[model samples]
Target chain A: MTMATVQTPPKISAQGVNVFYGDTHAVDNVSLDLYQDEVTALIGPSGCGKSTFLRCLNRMNDTIADCRVSGQILLDDEDIYASQIDVVQLRARVGMVFQKPNPFPKSIYDNVAYGPRIHGLADTREDLDEIVAVSLEKAGLWDEVKDRLDHLGTTLSGGQQQRLCIARAIAIDPEVILMDEPCSALDPIATAKVEALIEELKGGYAIILVTHSMQQAARISQKTAFFHLGQLIEFGDTTQIFTSPTSGRTRDYITGRLV
Target chain B: MTSLPNLKKRWGRPQVQRRLRRRYIYERIFRMLGLAAIGVAGLALATLIVSVGKNAFGGFVQTSIDVDIYLNPEDLRPSSARYRHDFAERVESADMRKLLADALERQFPDIDTDSERRRALQLFSLQARRTLRDYITATPEKIGQTVRMRLLASDDVDQVVKGNIDPRVPESDRRVKDKELAWLAALRADGRISRQLSTTFFTGGDSREPEIAGIFGAIIGSVLTLLVTLLTAFPIGTLAAIYLEEFSPQNRLTAFIEVNINNLAAVPSIVFGLLGLSLFLSILELPRSSPLVGGLTLALMTLPTIIIASRASLRAVPQGLRTAAQGLGASPMQVVFHHVVPSAMPGILTGTIIGLSRGLGETAPLLMIGMVAFVVSTPNALTDAATVLPVQIFLWADSPERAFVEKTSAAILVLLGFLLAVNALAVWLRQRFEVHIPD
Candidate 1:
């Protein structure tokens, strides 16, 4: 839309990346650029590795012992898998929200305070309190939950709990937030609320979202990436990816012809 | 109608004749026999309770004589009121019968005037006077009053009043000999030999006479055993479970350890006693019959139960919770301790309580470790030779006297009551500590 927007280096770059679960090559080599300060959506059929590629950005697949990853994943022009980089430290910079909302069995305040406490970002009780308040406010859940700060995080409704989890992740002040289908578990209203929160989140943090709903991807994301058989079939601005695509797979998927 | 039609339409064999019904007569017989066996086992439990109840309830009733023992407060009272506490301690003490004898003689010209009828004093629980004396001594100001205290007579008196004694028995065969019975009748005419319920069963200690020993010492010993068991078992069990379940690598050595744990849980508790005997008693030369050694043996037996329970609790914490913690950049150990561990606490407590209940009635193991029959002035320390409720019951059951039979039954009742109370406490704690864990 503007010359300044076209000038920024990608926040993350994936080139010929492949993911294997033992002998099963679940994700094929694919290349894409995820930019900072934008909602980049990944959508495909089930098992198309859309979520798998999102997981690769933060090295979340390292948890599964049998999962093997290949090719280069770069963050800010350097390979992220360099021997000196610790995954724990990397994860702190890149937070995650899973498909199902999993809130901790702790109070609302503690849930928000957990990330800051773990990362040693806040030293005093007052500092921790301020971080929780700010994080919850960013997630747009503070006003609804401020009165019940002592209530267990798990005791919230599905939508509130998901938002609380997002707030908990963001409290660490991560540079990029990876959300794996964060709204697939919610109703339409809750989904809209999450999309709005993502739009708001994009100003300060780069967001990589995976979703099965094509309309959802088109609605909020600035950039869109379509994956098929673990390959990045297409990547472009959301309007171009939705209305006009360079690849046949992307065209078929957008037209509801390809699974 | 369908079967008949099928038979008529059958091309090869008649359908009704070819069909095989599900039940075989032989199989039916076996099934009936199995069910019958299960029913018999279930009924046997009730039978044991009834039989044990019949024997133990006999101890709560006592034979007593309304002894009019006069007291000399000046003789017992020192310059200060401090010794007055010792007065009750002396009166309701295990040796209260002797103390009452001395006090009566101090004030009366002929206190031994009724030594002949003293044999008839068996109608009262002797523990009652010891209790009264102890109470008055605790509050020494009440020592001079001529209060008509309803002192307990004796266990033999309890049996006769409860109608447990057979009237047809000969004098030579009965502790309540014919001559003693005649003396009891004479006192009864004077309204001096009245039977009353005994609470001394809860306050006194063991002796050769069934009429004297109370469960006070055993209760203290059992409580101390539990305290020791908890102290040793809890942290050790919880740490072991956390290491095995959350941190340790999966390998043959770990698998072997896991197998051993399950096996250890099934090992006869007596083996733990024998191990304790060799290691704690014989080699270490700790005092035999100490609650310390007994507690250690029980602790060893309880550890496996607690570990298994703790592991189960840890496993019950949903994987989602751990993922949530990790996604927030929490360390793996933090994920386990901060999120998972607290949710599992209720289960751990329940398991510990159950382990305690099992340890409470463990007589065979305790006996092997020498907590069965040593006499003590008091439970002065953990290593002192002490008796527990089950051990007391075991000893009472083995005694040659018939009076002890009733004592044995009463001890059984007390042990069961302790179990009930402990279980209730566990349930209360579980409910209070319950996390947001789903059913």
Candidate 2:
């Protein structure tokens, strides 16, 4: 590798994380570093534990009654998996976007304002409206929905709803944002819009994107990691990984020979 | 194989066409059967309403006698010192029966015999004394002017006017004597008797005399009972349902409780009556025949229904909403109160109203608590001895008097009206406030 990398302390770091659902070992020992102000994409096949690991960052797996997680995840050098850590504050700091565009049954203004209002981020109506407007602008949806802020969030188109969810996640000013196949339910045109939004959102917050589209990872992500059969195979710069992957499985997956 | 020729042969087969025709015929038969079942139920309900309505209409117009009551100065201003001290004693001590008898004598001066006086007195209602007392108390100044007032007719006389006595029947078989019938006909001819609207039926209280009995007492009792039941059942049932559906861990104990609640819903309603008799009436020593005890008993009976309905509505809230709220850093309680409960509110209200209707019409539960009493005055408080509509109807239906049959049917109609009103309100609320989420 001829490129000189700028070294910095990781924004979030995982050490020997393992996840189990009842008796099934869904994710075996895996560790990785997510850098600050960079978009890191996790590319993998189905059932490859990419989504599971992404959920671990904010402890989203705790919602599942049967799920169990044992390992250490640290955000800003603070251990997130500690028993004394409040999951509500953890989720507020690290927000998530589901694969499906699941907006709440509320007006667009309220949907975006929900997180901030719940966290007491705004003290007045003007403050809440300003927060909502700014979050929507950041998600690249303000121009389209600004005139009809009172419209129901569910009435929006698929792509707009996905962007609305992104706006909702950033409304609380989360430090890290996790996205799980956000474009899987959208068409190519909408997918292009979200990919562009991700590019624009790159430097403001740490982003961990789990996607099945390799071209998505290559086009928008700066660093990429490949996972297979519950194991992290390779991690490097997106350009280097796409051109000269160090692992044979990553090569096979990139070349479409593994299928 | 000759594939093209074989396909052509199968396409043109007569047996396949015949099978398709038979299948269509069977589908028609099943559709007709389903429609027939629904039509049968609708027809039965229509028949019941029509029959009850026809019988209830007779009770709306009551037979009344416009008697000329002479206010004897001696009767109104009694000569006793106690009468001067207590005005109620003056009205009460006045011999209204003797006054009515004297009025009857003046109306028919030719009837001078002892038997004639007894038969003439029978034309007046058993409640005629109280009616005179009330009039004397209300308008004491008019007593000496000999005012004409409409008093409730006797039950037998009311039955005769309603055409239920069957004048063609033998004299011995009828409760109305020949003499009384002749007096009724003479009164009708003289324009002294008329079919006036039964305003008393709506305003007066329960009575042994069907002519004077009214549904006001029972209606008020039902309102208080349902209010108490709703106050007790709705919050407890809804909270329990939320806990069971949204917060409870799916463990053996929870499963056992769920099964037990379902089983409790199927328990006979009368068993709940017995439980109330023991727990509320006997153990707690609450006032017997009071709306409080009756309401508490019916609340226990209605709890399972409300819980089941509330849980169903809570379950109908999409799981996605819960996730969305949690992803926004809302706590577990917030996830439920902010999203799931709001979405489930309409369903819960509808279910609660339906359950309350069941409690409103319940008679057996109230019966076990001695609510089937002869309440003469309308209950003004929930703790007073009261009878609900269903219990009043039961008491009237058991009476041997022919007029009571009509009163019983009228009470049923009122009860049905109340239930329909409650259900309509529920439907209106559901449509107005229910949140519709896009799929």
Candidate 3:
């Protein structure tokens, strides 16, 4: 497996990022660059700081009282950690899906329309309906939920709820989508559906997926980074990371020997 | 034969048999103890209800004696022609006791002696003269006409008729004399008496005479006070809860506030009354014995309850909803009001209702603020002199009249009924508004 190099400038660049929870350093300094329309998968064992790094991309760590992040993360040459950058606007441009299907306790239509309404992406009810329909269709959920748009989002099955959350995220037209094990709570069939959805979503958004399943990272992501003990060990093409990793630690993790 | 051998072998283990027997016996004892505890509580509640109901039943039906009153125009007119402007003023200025005694003497011809006349007058309520005066003042043209009015009987007569006082008891021991008993029996036999609903109990104001006294003023005072408490406590408690749970930084100061709020709930309610007296009355100089003062005191007492309950409900709301709203770029305020608050509303309201009920039952704080005063008129405004139901019960229970014992019990039942309504509303709101999410 060989690395496929792209000369275009990176969409999001992180340099020497470190995260701390109180006195415990949860995530050590790491540097990486992600390009537009690419799926970058962060693979690690439990508590290996993959999810923490993903949260830092959108400033989600700010919600935790003791969590402290020290790093320089730039989106389109603008530092996101700058004092003038509002967290609300930062989250609007970088949407997130949690490990569990955390749909809002609202009607399906309302759930999908929430982001667009709050962001004022739609000016009228018709515009909102159109955005909701298009977003749901994009998430591959419109056909299953079209007849019952008013049904509560929580009443749906696990797979449909996850897709509904994806639809909700996409309704705001975010540039970056962060998934923290979005399919961990689903069955095999649901996982496959989410994987296909993520693959299709990479065409328009820079997607960063944190997954425990090595096979999922190889199948969906173009680039893969292996993390161990709060530190990034190796990063390269997904095929090279899976078939022939440069670092012995990454090789041991890929082979399920050092989990 | 093989199965029998295995069963015998298993049963032969001493440890297993002893453990099984001990567990069975322990289970039986635990079940019996639980049942006994429940039975004790149920019996206690039943005994209280029966005792209160028995005493209150008689209060619902009051005894009245019919009397024919004649208001002479000469007696009603000013004696020296001082020229009173209105009939109401003249009625107020006239000697009602003399007018009523003259009219009542016509009903009893044998009461020529002063002692007999006094005994006959003892059958009528002390407030009977005022009732006649009010009737005359209302209809001035009715003077000189014989108007038959059903007036409230005296406490002794009311008790005797209600079987609370035994007429067969010794004359010295019982308050009702033999002559009064005989007159009561004769009045009953002559169809000059009636037992009807105590409509006056729901309409009349507080009086020194228990037979004429009513809880109407206290009910109004309680309603007005509760309205003030709800308006003051609900919003403040909810906002405080939201700030503490959703917005406050987790530091020593916030932890101190949280712990103090919980401790405030456990503080004895009487201390709040003292606080109200000193803060609202002495320092603020609000009017004494008014619902405004009483309600403010009760609100202060209710605040801790509401805040604690609201915080619990706010904490009960799923953290996932807040994350979801925030993930969608909603500000912290939007996350709370649009998502967390809506999801926590049923719980918040249930807590608020419970707090309001506690305020309704509280008497000490209000008494500290001078709500124990005898309020003769229903309060027309927040600043008017007023009392609450529990204080009304305290006052009635302190009265020397036997009839007031029944009135006190009846007032307690009224208070319980109101509390039941409020709790029922809380349950209905929980059923209608609370969302049950599957895990």
> Individual DockQ of the candidates?
0.47, 0.69, 0.64
Model 1 scores what on Cα lDDT? 0.80
TM-score for each of the candidates: 0.82, 0.94, 0.93
Number of backbone-clashing residue pairs for each candidate, in the order shown: 23, 0, 0
Q: Ten-residue segment with the worst summed lDDT in candidate 1 chain B? A: B102-111
Query: Candidate 2 recovers what fraction of true contacts?
Result: 0.63
User: In candidate 2, which residue pairs get closer than 3 Å at backbone N, Cα or C atoms, i.e. clash?
Assistant: none
| DockQ for candidate 2, C-alpha atoms | 0.69
lDDT of each: 0.80, 0.89, 0.89
Tens-place lDDT digits, model 1, residues B1-439: 3445664456565554445333466678899999999999989988978998887766776666655554456445444434434443444333445446553344233335576325434444555655656656666665566545556656565566566677688767786776555545655686866654556667777877687777888888898888899999988998899899888877899999999999999999889989989989889988888888888889999999999999999888888887777777777788788988888889889888888899998988898887887453357679876899999999888997778888888889989989999999999999888878422
Task: State the lDDT of candidate 1 residue by residue for A1-259, as single tens digits.
Answer: 5355579988888888999998888789988888888889998889999888888888888777689889888988878777887778888988999889888778899889988887899989999999999999999999999999999987998889889989999999988899999999999899889889998899878899998888889998988988888777888899989888999888998889997
Candidate 3 per-residue lDDT over residues B359-418, each given as its tens digit:
999988887889999889999999999989999999999999899999999999999999
For model 1, the stretches where C-alpha displacement exceeds 4 angstroms are: A1-6, A77-80, B1-58, B68-154, B196-199, B437-439
Lowest summed lDDT across 10 adjacent residues in model 2 chain A is found at A1-10
Model 1 chain A scores worst on lDDT over the 10 consecutive residues at: A1-10
Model 3 lDDT vs. the true structure? 0.89
DockQ, ranked from best to worst: 2, 3, 1
Candidate achieving the largest DockQ: 2
The number of the candidate with the highest TM-score is 2
lDDT of model 1 at residue B13?
Answer: 57
